[model samples]
Target: MRTSIVAVLYVGGWALFAWLGDSWWQLLVAVALAVVFTQLGFLAHDLGHRQVFRTRRPSDIAGLIIGNFGVGLGWGWWTTKHNRHHANPNHEDHDPDVSPAVIVWSEDQVARSSGLPRFISKYQAFWFFPLLTLEAWHLHIASFKALLQPTAKRRGLELTLLVTHFVLYFGLVFAVLPFGKALLFLAVHQGLFGIYLGCSFAPNHKGMPILTKEDELDFLRKQVLTSRNVHGGLLTDVALGQLNYQIEHHLFPNMPAPNLRRAQPIVERYCQEIGVDYLQTGLVTSYGQALRHLHEVGAALREPTREPTR
Candidate 1:
């Protein structure tokens, strides 16, 4: 039902943009689409987790529809990458989310980086939010490359859906507005969409404890310690797509989105009983902590006299 509303809004936005003159209305439509698209992407994430269906096939189909067709992302690629992240949340080498060239999560990673990467790592905290403006475009290009790789599975279907998404997405924009307006529309849509997506994800695990390959911890402890929940009510729940319950979601990846809130107390109590560090904070606080952690990791790079171990 919720997905239906989001889908309607997404399609309607395109239609409204096409009919409306090239003015503020068009930009408004782009912003609306970006918000709608981000929500659809969240639903797609739920599908990838098999939370929307009892069986894997139906979930995959839904993911392909919402993720590939609607959100212009490769469902197969996302599923694979996301699963790996779930399997190893903050493991520096194992988690793809931590392998950012712009921001180094660990001092070791920062130390290993050289030249441009090292330079960026020196002040990545300041550049983080601004750099996310281009993340949507980066993900699109990355998805295409991942889907086109010889090692990628379901190449034919994935590539076909991705290509179809591109054709329809750009075709509608070009058809509705002039070339210049279309470019502006695209920029607005993708830029806001990228920031929206990044803001939703970064607070979940960004400032959490980083685990080394040699580290050994129980599953429950690892999940709870590495994940941070954002404190909020219904508004945050809807905006973050239930990802505010990050600790619970990571501990139970297959749990449905709506159930996360209900399960939160249970998870928190269990963590308490087990003496685990269940991190929860306000959204702004979480972002601040994430930024601070990034800066802390890069501090050694800025001061040559400082020990890298610090």
Candidate 2:
């Protein structure tokens, strides 16, 4: 039923785009498509975690379809990277999520930056939300790059589906709309889609504990401490793709997305009983915490240099 709903909305959005001629409403269609695409992306995430199917093969097949073809991201690449993140949620060394790029999550990573990156790191917290507008395109590019590498797993199938996706996606847009409208459609769709994706995932671990190579903890503790739950009712659940239950989802990666809500109370009680710091906050609050953390890490760069005494 969930999959059916997602398919309908996604296809309907595309159909609406095809149906609309030269009009300002195409931009609204772009927003609608961005939303539906993000939902499909969450479904793809579930498939990658094998939470949607009983066996690995079926899930992988579904992931390839929903993730690669529907969403234009490589399922194999995503799964490999995501699994490593689960194994070490916020560990600087192992978790690709925290590996420094545009924004530094820790002071150590901020210190390591030099040249252009160093300059950027100083203002990264301010730029984080804005930069997220490009994240979907970034992931798409990363997916193709990873799949094209010789060492990538399931390279052939992933590449094929991804290529097919771009062909159909661009083909439909360009065929139906004028060049300028096509450009606007692509820009709005990809930009809003990326922001939606980043907003959903960043709050999960951004402000939580940062683990290092030498740090070790039990699985439960590690997952709980490094994850934050966003508080809202059903709307939040649907918007964030059940990821509002981040602590529960991280603790039980293979649990079905629908089941995460039910598991939240149990997980929260368990954390309380065990004396773990289970963080839960409103969406705005969580974003603030994440940005504040980013700002704090970048503080050294933002500091003014003192004048030398004569």
What are the TM-scores, per candidate, against the unseen true structure?
0.97, 0.96
lDDT of 1 by residue, 41-136 (tens): 999999989898999899988899888888889989988999999999999889999985667898888768777777888898998888898999
Model 2 residue-pair collision total: 0
User: For candidate 2, lDDT tens digit of each residue in 127-203?
Assistant: 99889889999999999999989999888888999999999999988888899989999999999999999999998
The count of residue-pair clashes in candidate 1 stands at 0
Give candidate 2 regions above 4 Å deviation: 305-310
TM-score of 1: 0.97
Mark the 10 consecutive residues where model 2 has the least summed lDDT: 301-310
Task: Give the winner by lDDT.
Answer: 1
The residue pairs that clash in candidate 1, if any, are: none
